[model samples]
Target: MLPTVILPGYLESADVYLPLQQALTALGTPTTTVPLRKRDWLPTLGGRSMIPILRQLDRTVSAALVDNQAAQINLIGHSAGGWISRIYLGDIPYTIHGDVTEAEQLWNAKAKVANLITLGTPHISGERWTKKNLDFVNDNYPGAKHPEVRYVCVAGKSIYGEKKLGQWLAYSSYQQTCGEGNTWGDGITAIKAAHLTGAINIEIEGVKHSPRTPGIWYGSPAVLPQWTGYLS
Candidate 1:
């Protein structure tokens, strides 16, 4: 069973998380998507403002889901979604410089991260790297206070490039931003990258995207069995 929550990436709709949410729920686990409001700071800071945003998000999600008792929760995120997930699961106490108890800190993971699953995210000292981002996904975050939760990264197999009408215009910009090889859901992020960052990665291949596809497709049940072990 899963006691997890899903978070979406930038310019994404809550719809992106619906499939996985339903899948977990079908497995008889509670799941929900954390709704994010449009913020003025998002464009300027990107997800680098993740610490504060997660603190605020923790308040809303914990309130709505746990009634103040959200102890063990799996956090599944993609892209910028994964960035926020790392900040939420991490234990540095909101980078805002506060003295809050670890248990009382944002996302309140004094217990431990039940699971941290990321999809198509860059978790190491990559091209546009920053120390803050480096610490969690990069340094594996000290003060975990528990066994670092199981980490599963599902990356794309095929690289998306500016070859045709579809891939070039849409995906080229995203890859260029990170100095990453052009990719969609099929590009494999090096496992060495995960080792350097201290997270277990589950590499999946051949499920490319077209920017036309939204979140999980209704047909993904066929692929679900393949990833079930990773989910476990």
Candidate 2:
């Protein structure tokens, strides 16, 4: 089995995914997470650039390859990490901030990835703050762009976005993510926004977006079985 690397979401530290790493290990799949702390995301706070995060991801991938003695590995990116993983897998130069030099063009990771599983990732976004990065990802590497790597997009259907007070947050998040608010989502990303056109899309009925949220999430022990089957 190919070793797996878990890329946590924006502002999330690697420690938050320990439960998930342990679960995957118990299933016989060697797993590791990019050693990222919340402080590491501070530099990219204003949508400036994700180059720093990508660099950490590259190092972790390299280490996973060497340590596991595997030619390729599986990547499981949650939330924003998912789209960032898309950028990592592409050959196109990511030029959002216009700071990526030729020497920094080492993020073309498709050759080292066997499968990619995204959890409640907003593949599309309408918010102005995130437009530049999202645009670059969509324009350069569209849905399921790489045929060699399997793409499995998972969305949770625990919350229905509504204008009411109880669901207003979900409603607003869905609107910002996919330009639609009155839809089903995982409390942060709408199902439509989380899915890719040519990927194997899945929707879990009672899951939330993150582990911190009430109820089961993508990384939850119960939910892992729902999508981990696609890892190999």
Candidate 3:
């Protein structure tokens, strides 16, 4: 099987995904985490342009392809990494905010991508930093409609954040991500937003947004059975 490249979420470093990478390796899918960090993403985040980060992801993809010596590789992206992977898979145009320059194509889609698995990714975002970029992703790629690649979306159902302490943290995150907090979600992302219309959608009962001390996220060993099958 081709090795899987794991992409971390926003403001997260590559090391944060080590637990999940270990789990996937044990499950027979060799994995690698993209060496990404918050400092590397600061430019794109502040400038509202995803060009730099997308380039970084592409470099990782190229390295994975060389390391595994395969024509195609599996992509596992968490949170914003998921949508960013979509942009990486095609020749999509992107522009910097407040810049009058013409939009540029970040990736040329020459790399072969076999499967794409997303964990608690908020495909839709209401925040200004991601809204326009996500709009481009949703409009062009739109769900798992890509003809060549298999798309799998994994969602968490542990915290809805409707009231109390959960409301303050998880609910606020949900509201920021999807514009509502009275629904079932993984505290950071909503199930409905995490899934694409034509993709393989899965909902885990107690998964959180990421691996925590007492609970597991999508890549934790406890929940490997839920979405590992798609790695093939």
Best prediction by TM-score: 2
What are the models' TM-scores? 0.68, 0.98, 0.90
| Model 1 agreement with the true structure over 1-82: per-residue lDDT tens digits | 5466666655565665677678877875577777655462264263354554565557545653464264566666655566
Model 1 stretches with alpha carbons more than 4 Å out: 37-48, 60-71, 96-104, 107-112, 125-146, 160-198, 209-219, 230-232
Put down candidate 2 lDDT per residue, 77-181, tens digits, no spaces: 999999999999999887768777757875789999999999999999998878888899998889999999999999999999999988999999999999989
Instruction: Name the weakest run of 10 consecutive residues (lDDT summed) in model 2.
Output: 98-107
lDDT of 1 at 105: 63
lDDT of 3 by residue, 31-120 (tens): 888888769888776427676677677777778788878788899889888888888776555553544234544555535788999999
Q: Against the true structure, whose lDDT is highest?
A: 2
Comparing candidate 2 with candidate 3, which one achieves the higher lDDT?
2
lDDT of 2 at 15: 95
Supply the TM-score for candidate 3.
Answer: 0.90
**In model 3, where do residues sit more than 4 Å from their true spots?**
95-105
